[model samples]
Target: MAQEHLDRLTAVDASFLVQEKESSHMHIGGLIIAEGPPPAYDDLLDSIRSRLHLVPRYRQKLAVPPLESGRPVWVDDPNFFLEYHVRQTALPSPGDEGQLTELAARIFSQRLDRDKPLWEMWLIEGLSGGRFALISKNHHALIDGISGVDLGQVLFDLTPVPTQFPTAELEPWRASRTPSPVRLISSGVLGAARTSSRLAAAVLRAASNPARAAGVAKEAMTGVADIAWATMNPAPETPLNVEIGPHRRYVTIRSDLRDFKEIKDTLGGTVNDVVLTVMTAALRNWLHSRGVRTEGLELRALVPVSIRAKDEQGNLGNRLTVMRGALPVYIDDPYERHRAVCAAMGDLKESKQAVGAEVLAGAQNFAPPTILAQASRLNFSTRLFNLLITNVPGPQFPLYVLGRELLDVFPIAFLPENHAFATAIMSYNGKINFGLLADYDALPDLGRIGEEIEAALAELLALARAERAGASGNGAAAPPRIGAS
Candidate 1:
């Protein structure tokens, strides 16, 4: 008999699986474009096969105990086939970004099969330039934004020449025999007991150092209060929040990272502040275009903050918490809007929102599968935020897959029930790419929002230049145009 192996899912990771619904898929990934001719499908397969050992979890699938006695565990998939997870497809006619976006939307619409590993990579050929795109989707239960970035290092090479691993160094793999129902139940009970024991030990340790524990407890309580308040006070209803169908529309916005930094430097705030400002401006204009009055309107964005420590860089599963970031669309001036964002974000950073979220999420560890499912749903209730906005930092240098250089990356964020719009941003190789996913029917004007984003950037850039010129008392000394190096 093969060695029996089992790894239980963390509560945060398990939440994603329970949160997934027919209309709301919980997969997160990106649309990646690379320069140079596409690599042969067989060669790409061979490259992935060699590096499979780096991410052993990818070869495994989930196993739920009989009657859902405990959270699912990761077990090896005996019939694992590389071809099934990695697929190849081509666009028809002269391939362009529009066609690719449509294709990506369709691919993202379908959820991964429950019986297989929760991920897929689609190698798409036939683009306008001598480049190709890869659409990667992984269940949220499998990975989060920070860990996903780590996965990139494993899949892509730093230089143009690809790294090769000799098969002699790597051993063959085999799946352990699947655990029977009785064993699963017993293991679940034991796991629960171990968790309780660990928690009790932590509590005892805290009790020993009462002063330190008191300070931590106070901070946690404050954070919990903020989170509870946010939950009770529902965000204002907007065109962006409504019943979402299974179909989606995907749009991308290309921007230079320098523009954001310039705005931040000229206008006294962080790069993220500039980003939030642009988003707010775009939302204001989009709402107006849709005949909605935007007086005194402040939309809320569910911003995910990564808590993954440096030591846990490559570990999988979610290590994130959410905060309700305010989007002050009511501010008419771009600079004023940016200032408001900076101030609000600064306050949020100092507050206990994220800490409270972590504490609440940790409590789910003791919850049974049924309770965990309901609690997970409640944690992401529609009243908490209007839309989701996530920004992930990436490597500054170029990355290559089989010598093909990765040119651009547009990260995709999944939609929650009744939420029609979400934006995911990734800054790579000096360029910041925005991927906007929307409900196809609810957002036929998604392209219009993309246009508004560009317009907002231009407006902010001009203001920043003017401010710099005034500060320096020389117009020529102001920063060059946005795209300037």
Candidate 2:
């Protein structure tokens, strides 16, 4: 097979790298729990070794061109050591989920070493319920949630029993000769030239039709301005929108898929709407518990929308845009909250806020690294959204690790500055699991948020049931399920 050229990071991908700070870690990962007695370290190592060929990015390290001429590229790590990337550790005796989560939070607090492949997997043993765990972490620039599908598939088996993958036919990977520094610099120079030429051509082509060019320019300018305004002028500040530190805490809650679908079907909202409504209620309850006023106020969440096309399934890096969510938490009625959330989301979809975010993210491609890095600092310098809520789809089938069936898996949400909390959601089999990230200093009782989510979901489900009965000629709808049970 022919050798591939250096794979440079895309603009949005590079932004994640540039946006990194000592106070905020930008990597994403999952804290996974599997049924145990745990698999042997050697067994887990062998499993990953056999599949390493499928993910070349795993073995490659970050390489930046001289003078920051272009985005960082992926190059073979000549000193790559598989054992270092795949680690083994035992949780203390009586290793309950709480202890395991504490360990995960510590790991999440630290930044990945840029010297090697920006990923790691820890095999954790000694959970209370006869189980072990796989703590997976990867840099945001290396893989988005959609692009990380292969990683999950490679590490898990569909059945409780492991299946053998054919390895004999696979070609061995040998480190290619590293290009000279002079060559790398020259490549950057030429790449910059081509980029410049492309931009010039695009400008000239658009300029050929003055009126059309003006219209396009206006749209682009408006999009950039709108995104800036949305980021700067977010909803009324809340307790969750405070400055954060490096330390982090994580907690998770899960909902039944059938339950969510039933609510969606009966309440006349999308699954996404139901999910947002749940968050609205949980956030409202959490604030009210903290003695914060929640009357007639709304909280804004920055929700990410994936723009990756179906054909671009296997490619790594960021391919998503942010959309604003105005969650009406002040509403006392669960049905009213759901309806408002659904309407707001519909408007957001039609408003093209995500398109504007994409346009803004793409502009970073032309920005010099210094300027881009500075922009990142500014972006995180001020408060934007109260929370960054993200939901990614996962395989609905069961997954196993060395015959240890996975009971629950939750994605880690990396918190940005001035954002004390973030939420990540993923669906698998028949459950939708939500992971919460918060500043350790700000929210020591992060577990309460998880409980709140369950409570809120229950409330919404009851409302859906009431709505269903009313439609069936049962009389006016039951009173809203809110406040105390």
Candidate 3:
């Protein structure tokens, strides 16, 4: 059966598209270094080819309506060629960690071609050790699942044994004639009319149930108003925000997830609090090294919160909202910083900041694609938030591809316009991995920031261990107090 209805991009997702520019590439990706006896490049390509049906979006290309009439839609690319997207490459002779990081950074700096499917998979071989790495990239619009996070979990299995995926029946490719100009305009008009009708219906229903509708409307309006008012002030100017170049530099940081949990469990704060505490400390140090004074400074961070339900794992696309978090940049003490972050996050949660922001974001669904894109650009150009930091949890158990044991997984997140640095955190097995991305020229000392993160975490971990030891020596284990919702 030929599909008739177009798969359109939601306004929130379209916002990402409009926001993307030469300096800022909006994609979420990961670098995976696997263990010995690497599989042949052909075998890996075969594996991905066989499973493309399971992820139909992989072969679909974007179709923008005429004159930006409406949001873009997903259309099967009749000229889809798997080899163009899945590539093979070899690292320099005596491939070492240094060379691999450089290679990954260069690959990440290049933007994905919007004309084809917005994704790529590089099968890299010839490492210093008998190992290989897979660098995967996908546009923010494609894998924008809950919280706007994904390392392509759908492409792997839980164990090293490659489970044979039953071949799913796929639709054969058949090119359709291009839509007429009249057809595109009609589509846009229809979309707008539908939105208007829904608004009218909502009003009528509210009029019928005056009491219930008024209550709901009042609450929603209040939430949106509070969020808008709170964000009117621009974020503090800092070295972290600057004019960025088209090139990007990548850095990775590693730590045990248990260390973070240990600190949170014993210190009476959430895991996120501990993470922020350490991140703030590192950011403070990094800025100080750049000769910037950090006294009485509070850097705002745009943190993504996913509203997708647990069972909606396989359904991709953006279902995310933003939370404005105030990082305590002035606080020098690690424990004090942790407490401050916990308190601020707790308040933000209580205020339902994300809820209000989401309500406002939902309004975009009724907006035109052009208008939505420009609005996002405005937010990016003006330093609305100091930066973005996201922590996504990966599988604790091992995942494999073509019988290869997946080792480390580091996620490289998007850096918006004028925003020079961003961090994407992911924890797998026993380790928490951090991928730091920065403008290649603006932040050449990016590794210094990564080093600080590691150093700060190490300091906090040592303190937590000593504290836990003291409590154990004195009495029974202290119960953890819950704070954030």
TM-score of each: 0.97, 0.90, 0.93
- The parts of candidate 3 lying over 4 Å away from their true place are 1-4, 145-151, 168-180, 197-212, 476-485
Per-candidate RMSD vs. true structure? Answer: 2.9, 3.9, 2.4
> What is the lDDT, from 0 to 100, of the residue 103 in candidate 3?
88
**What does the lDDT read for residue 71 in candidate 3?**
83
Q: Model 2, stretches more than 4 Å misplaced? A: 1-4, 160-163, 196-222, 378-381, 473-485
Number of the top-ranking candidate, with TM-score as the measure: 1
Error of 3 at 162 (Å): 1.6
| Full ranking by lDDT | 1, 2, 3
lDDT of 1 by residue, 1-485 (tens): 47878889999999999888898999999999999699999999999999988999999999899998998988889999999999999988799999999999999999999799999999999988988999999999999998999999999999999998886776687778888888888878988999999999999999999999999999999999998888888999999889888998999999999998988777767777788889999999999999999898999999999999999999988899888899999999887787788888888877889999999998889999999988888877788788999999999999999999999999999999889999999999999999999999999999999999999999999999888878688534554322111
Pick the winner on TM-score between candidates 1 and 3: 1
Ranked by TM-score, top first:
1, 3, 2
Please, what are the lDDT tens digits per residue for candidate 3 over residues 1-485? 24445577767778888888898898878888888777887888878877777777887888887787888887777788989998889898989877888888899889999999899999889886799998888899887623323435667767778877654655554545445566666777787788789889988998999999978877777777656766687789987788787888888887899899988877768778888888899999998998988899999988888877777766868878787788999999887887889998888777767777677677888877766876666546545689999888777878888888888888888888888999988888898899998989989899999999999999888878777888788896764544742
Error of 2 at 388 (Å): 0.9
lDDT of each: 0.90, 0.81, 0.81
User: Per-residue lDDT tens digits of candidate 2, residues 90-119?
Assistant: 889888877888899988998999999999
Model 3 local distance difference test score: 0.81
